[model samples]
Target: MLDSDYTQRFLFDDTDVRGEWVGLERSYAEVLAKHSYPEPVAQLLGELLAAAALLVGTLKFDGLMVLQARSTGAVPLLMVECSSDREVRGIARYDESLLAPGATLSELMPDGVLAMTIDPTNGQRYQGIVALDGVTLADSLSNYFASSEQLPTRFWLAADGRRACGMLLQQLPADRIRDSEEREASWQHLRTLADTLSAEELLGLDTQTVLHRLYHEEQVRLFEPRSIVFRCSCSRERSANAVISLGQQDAEQLLAEQGGAITIDCQFCNHSYRFDAADIAQLFAGAGTEGPSGTRH
Candidate 1:
């Protein structure tokens, strides 16, 4: 995987809605390394990662956006989180014994919901869920946009061994007197061109080149790119704070049973952090001296 990749936000001057295209290579590789996932599961995650970035980048929201799938099948759950800064992390839960070699989402996950959560840094969190309504990740996402946003949207996602990429086209909201029929005609033409895109082209072609191939007749404005990277918000201090939150008695008992300190492992990145007896003691002592402090370690 490469270090950090870029997500480009683009707008059609005549269309009401904005869109984004993101290609992830190294970031996706880092996320896939968190666990041993089957090929289907890995591919699902790559598409989900690209989709999550697309949604976040398109909205231009200063919040955390999450894409999650939960089901009562072999692949029970999968989720990816992306912040406005383009930091990303994800994980999947599955029945290893039941994993098929190349199960599709319909085969492995079956009935499920694709959920999106937007947690604004200063405001409330909003969530929207859509039925597993389409054949692939991109179609499901387009269905979500139609249902939730009432906007005509399209997604094209593709991944090979080396990189994963996705492109989105959306019809923005328009004014009453803007000749809606003309806009619709343009949209129809653009959509037809977009349909010509193949998986190989999506993953292999450069961003500008792809756009040119699809929308050569349209007036498109490409925004400044935002860099995306694999970033896990896990650390020893966070783990220690979690232990402290368990209360001194419970924490100490677990430590004693385990023979020493408490060990915490992050599910997203598989990073482990351990706190020794001294660390625990210091934590409780500080909490006592600081007068019921709500501070994190």
Candidate 2:
């Protein structure tokens, strides 16, 4: 059986190629449990979650990577975020009435733009956008890497609502001493081998078994696997800071309209935070000196 909720990185011993495999199980279940999403939405979110985890594994940074799609079709918005620490969270906004059985990617998000953002812990943010022109999320992401990063990348992603899994292969820059034609041929050979991978195999096989099945003849090095978990970064302090950023006048007005207390609910984790009049007073009083003092539920 596949080892779920983990990402493993691998490399080719003789080629400038690297790959990553991500399998999501417990983390996927945790995200789905927070909301009663429809079948189509849940499946799409699962795929995105897998993609985000795979992408994060490729980068060597201490930060967060977000994959988001915005559209006007049955599903208006889908987003998934994975931090360097391996915490994952995702949410989808859609119209259930329009979602039918076996809805395709275009049917769920027609005329959409897919954006990937990388926010580092101590550096400027970078974002890449591509049109959602493919039938699958994998296709669009492949296009993004080709255009934005100028890298030859391929992805195979699958999700069954219960388990989400994906594989990514990237051809790194060739060495100056290496023959250009030889490197090109090697890249094509590996890509062709990866192309033979089926969604069923990706979702069903463990990392070791899958790699051996695909590249038994080649020298492939597998790294230690990293665990992925469901975690929400939302807290009452952040919510309080958001409220304080609204300024004292507007904050008080919102509190008055809400019957002397304002509640903030995290869309990703369904965590609720409540701040009463006294809490608001303390927030404004210690605005610059301290953090929010609201209660979390």
Candidate 3:
């Protein structure tokens, strides 16, 4: 049986080109279940999630990778977060009334900026910014890697309403192939094979079949697959901390204004956390020992 929601890493045994394959089924459905997003926004979000997983798999990191885009068009914001552990979540901000039925990505996000942020657990955070210049998300990312990174990288991303999938192939630093011409040839050869993969095959086939179909002539070593999970890191404790950060005066004032429990809803998961007067009292009673603030800088 094929792994449906797992990300697998593979290396061309004879060359410096490495690739990653990610398929999101249950994880995709879980993200869609959190909100009733329009088709275009949903599709873009799925592609972002898939790309994030693929990048995290390619990079060596211990924390999180964020793919974010900001626009002044119909869709204002698209964000996807993938942890080193393959946990992924995504969200998109859009105006349904402004969307045309067949609006292209450029129309949806005109003059947008795409950014990739790698936040490590023990090191400094790094971010790469580029223009959203391509028709698809994959194009922009591939450009980022090729130009900003100065590395030959290619990305094939696909997402339907039901499934999100992606593959990434990147040429590593000079190792086995030291000659410039040989490295270029190898990179082009691998990319040529990868370009033959269609969106349908990517979304429909399993990892092994996909790899074999693409690189059967080459020596490839497949790594153990890592499962992708849909998870919101929000918790009641965090929500309560947020409430506490508002200070007692404002907290009580809001409670008075509402005439009932103060509800804090998580935008990512749409889960509401309510705190009543008594609950607020208990929270403050414990806040002295916890800290005066709970905000992250």
Candidate maximizing lDDT:
2
State the TM-score for model 2.
0.94
**What is the C-alpha lDDT profile of model 1 across 142-173, one tens digit per residue?**
88988986578898888664677898888876
- CA RMSD per model (angstroms): 4.1, 2.1, 3.7
Off by over 4 Å in 1: 1-4, 175-177, 287-297
Tens-digit lDDT track for model 3 on 57-136?
Answer: 88888998999999999999999998998888888899999999878889999999999999999999999999998888
lDDT of each: 0.81, 0.89, 0.88
List TM-scores for all candidates, in order.
0.89, 0.94, 0.92
Which is superior by lDDT, 1 or 3? 3
Off by over 4 Å in 3: 287-297
* Deviation (Å) of 145 in candidate 2: 0.7
Q: What RMSD does model 3 have? A: 3.7
Ranking by TM-score: 2, 3, 1
Q: What is the lDDT of residue 178 in candidate 2?
A: 83
Greater-TM-score candidate between 1 and 2: 2
lDDT of 2 by residue, 1-297 (tens): 335699999999888999999999999999999999988888889999999999888898999999999999999999999999999999999998899898789888999999999999989999989998788989888888888866788888998889999999988887531888888899888888888999899888889998998899989999999999999898877888898899999999999999988999999988888888888888899844243444555
